[model samples]
Target: MRCFMLHIACLCIASSLCAIGDDIDEAMRKSVPPQLKFLRVYGGDDESMPPIALTSRPTNLRRPNIPFNFSHVTIELDIQSPTPPQMFVVFSHCNADWSEHDNSFLNDPALLRTSSIDWRIAPPASVWYSYTGTLKIPNEHVKFNFGGNWKAKFYLYDDPQIPIAIAHFFVVDPRVETRLEVSGDFYSPRNTVYSSGAYTIDANVRSVDGMNDGQLNTAVFYRLNRYEEPFIVSDISSYEDVNQRTHAYPLQTMLAGFGMTGRRFRIERIPAENEYRVLNLADYSLFPRSNAPLRMLTPDLWRNGSFFEKSDGGFMNTRFIATGDRDYIQLEFLLNTQLIQAEREVFVSGSFNNWKPDPSWLMKWDEETKLYRLRQWVPRGRHSYLYMTGEVDADNRKAIRLTSEEFEGNTARAGHTFIGLIYYREFGMGGFDSIVGVAGGSVYGSW
Candidate 1:
């Protein structure tokens, strides 16, 4: 009956999603390919901090925005375990477009063999027990001779078909210099009726290497912050220069919606530290599921667009312990949705679920309590989460269209970051896309 109850619950939410509107069908079809599921995944230059529990890397290390060879970034993975199985990480090459490329570069022996990976057993830690694996590109076992797009797939060593986790990274040769200019604007230029905020991107590329033909055979890819999908442009007319070394592509329409800000609540904050305010998710016993709509954590003081600033002000804290053991907390999330009349579905999302709107995280409406609620075995740690609403498209997947702004309001202050990259492909000679330029930055916004 438990399985049947869950199925009914999913159907109810899925039905609500499909009923939202006609436009959502196209939006859902455009959903980017999902990443492989894993307990934890991290990537960055060799010198960056390793992935740990109870925390998320503030900036994505996988899509490095720095001007360096794509081979410079390394990926690390920690697979969740009951009894861990042997696993190996494999790399797949992609074209300037994110589609998989059927080129010989991926068939190289160095990448085909298991010797390229440096596997290690995770140190006994307070949060959870699992095996960790590392793969550094351009290592002795495998080297990325040419660059385009690369995805590292983790699979069982003995059974390659059984996959584990997946990560995306980049490599660049920097043959061209690219400049990006971003401006904030209303969603529509003519009217401000439903205005939140939008970004207009203008890009310019110039040949940095005298031998290169520059923007003539290049594609520019731009993404807002860490989003997986990229806005791409590749037209000779977009180039401002005829010698073809320089090109400019301006946004015809502003990218709509105020980018959702980071989570304001700190579930992982240490209690003894007077400066930090946090909800203690350690004791499920204290908060049991009851008829009176068990008031879960204290009524959250909605702080729109607020972010944490630790003493060190570093990207993440290395010394903080997020959880005590492998045991999970049966935490219930409660949100008052009485004022919300739209036929949209709501979800709780954060770094734990790769910032994606997951079905498991979907919240159900309670007619009696006039609230949306979900119960899950969440591990104790500092969790960053946002209350977002959207439809579960025909794909049965959730894509956000409305955030907590209904209650939280639009006047939240938060930081927004953007990353830009330029890719090039020569006419002949294996025709692989190579990175030529990179740039990234953050902007602060209120309302």
Candidate 2:
């Protein structure tokens, strides 16, 4: 029975493997349920909301590009209900395009590792529970000797087939170095508030492996910090061979600039003390192990991308220490806004929500109080957040998508991190795009 299942898994990858578009999307939606959310696989400490606090990190950024490292990667999930369920995580190696590699199951029959997870009951303030699973890649049992994309699927430990959650991660043996520089309008000097942010990238791509030169088709992808999607330069410009070992693909593209005027006259900055207001329902704080409604938190203004360092009562640079004693803390977020125009929605986005506009973070306007309110149950720690309002796409099923710079005003002083990725598709490879190299840097506008 085990051999039959192995053969089936191999066949699925070899044929339907790495298939994108509708097939892959449908498969992912069917495999993972929606209620099991905020699934992440990160390295270092697992206690932080975002294990890696880099805002410029890729949405798909799961693991550092180092392969066969000793660092442990942890997977975590939040179930909306307090009931603890029997969960198991299964790890699999996949090609760059995220399909099961053909040789994965055949060569290493033990390529798939399954481990059970114990769910911890969250604090009384939270309506949900948290489940954490950790795995050290290249440990005694599993060694990811190769570089590529990988996946971890969570399922019932007893059934082990119905996937409840899924996460995609990357393991890279970086054979190349990608250096990027931004030249134009690094600082917003022209305007006091609305800076017409125009910039281009100066890139130097070097490959240690001689085979990765201008001879192959290479592309560069870049994005501003906190944005969900990236802009792609499909056909890079000025592709030249600088030397035998290095290739220069100098490229630049326009970035979206922020506007000066909006519903809120100017970007409001709240006092440092009030930022990331903490709610302690523990035995010492207000409501202890009781269902009493906590006090209403004071409303805070837009932070303008200011992060709360772990030292300043924030979670940054610190790891979450699970005591199995603290209850969940519920904090209310408010945006002072009169009447939101029609077809517009407000969201509070940050590293906590992967910097994306999730429905859970959407704030509803309270007419009586005249504030957009959101009650979120966050793990104990400080966090940074930004308020964003965008138009709801009526034609596209009323999808709420944010526009660059309009809602989240980007100032010259606002720190922005840009990550440059270079993907190389060698001649005659029917497989996925291998991330040859990656480079990232932070830029602040100078007026």
Candidate 3:
């Protein structure tokens, strides 16, 4: 009787496997390849929210590029809508009175052209019912610890089952589930009313990954130094821009710049609940000249604010003399391994080169330095940049799509050789979110 029961159990297991295999086979057989394929790209593996970039450094920036005060986003769908009866899901962020991020995702200037941008999918239909989509984020832009506001919607045309169910998902950045550290120092003080000084200020930002990536956007605040008050004055300091982590990074190329002589100083974190949240201290007399290399926050405080020992956390108190003469600008950036000959081609293009792609700035293989590099006396503090690698071969004349290629997801070696990122199965979604990614690292930046 025991042997008979065992045989029955084996048969059940075999049947389930056979069913799964049959479903895949049938789905492909009936489904006709649609003209276009909907693709979602992000740095990390979070399907719901933003993607966290696991790739060590910033990879090659794709065609549509990264611009200051703005980001380029794109998503292609393979649904059966003829005109694709457009519908949109949005997160209307009040980032700068809603200017930089305008209501214009529908007008993607660089839409994938015919044939070149393959829209092939299995089985085309007249209408899409239960559709699914993916969201991509930059490497820097991460979610808040307790979750933040990220608006999303679903726009399906002519579908009676679900016409326009604008789904709103407000959840924390993926890091909340683990032990994540988000800390930084302020170049200037946050609430003091004071004039500018001959001091240099900068901050370092980072995230938790197999490789180190310290880059983020920080909201810096300035006020009069005399009376510790949040200065509402319209001085240059008051109208200064924010700071980023990747100093002189290709994303911007240079760090952030803040050159002003305000009476006092202070910096504020932006976006999250801590935006403009004043740094906590018993008195405003915390700014003093110390010869020691200042440790911003105590280990425990930075690690996880301790038992009120110094728990009122905000910006780490980092300041320089208020002498209003020196280059007060600060350049912050993230450093990933430099590009190699095997990975990408180098080209120098910009207004400096008559808006032409110059060969001089073309990266040279630094055998000695062991890195591909281009050095320029960038603006003192911070700036943005782009790394363009023109088309390579005939088939890959445009962007390389690993998803198009059928590889078993083995792009690298753990113990042996250092293989590049999986180029085949990994869908290379074009947009700022495709390469380094905007989420989970730094969302915004200014200079």
TM-score of each predicted structure versus truth: 0.62, 0.61, 0.20
Model 1: residues >4 Å from true position, as ranges?
1-71, 106-129, 188-195, 211-225, 236-296, 299-319, 322-330, 377-383, 393-413, 444-447
Query: Residue-wise lDDT of candidate 3 within 247-320, one digit each (tens)?
Result: 11111112232322111122232211111112222222542222222221321111011112221121122233
Please, what is the whole-model Cα lDDT of each candidate in the order they appear?
0.45, 0.45, 0.24
lDDT of 3: 0.24
Error of 2 at 138 (Å): 4.5
How well is each residue in 145-209 modelled by candidate 2, as lDDT tens digits?
A: 44444677777655666787776554444555555664434333223433334344444555554
The lDDT-based order of candidates, best leading, equals: 1, 2, 3
TM-score of 3: 0.20
- lDDT: worst 10-residue window of model 2: 262-271
Ranking, TM-score, top scorer first: 1, 2, 3
| Residue 9 C-alpha lDDT in model 3 | 99
Taking the tens digit of each residue's C-alpha lDDT, what string does model 1 give over 172-287? 55454555555544232122322244444444555533434433344444322123334444443333122122111123322211112111100010001011123343344664
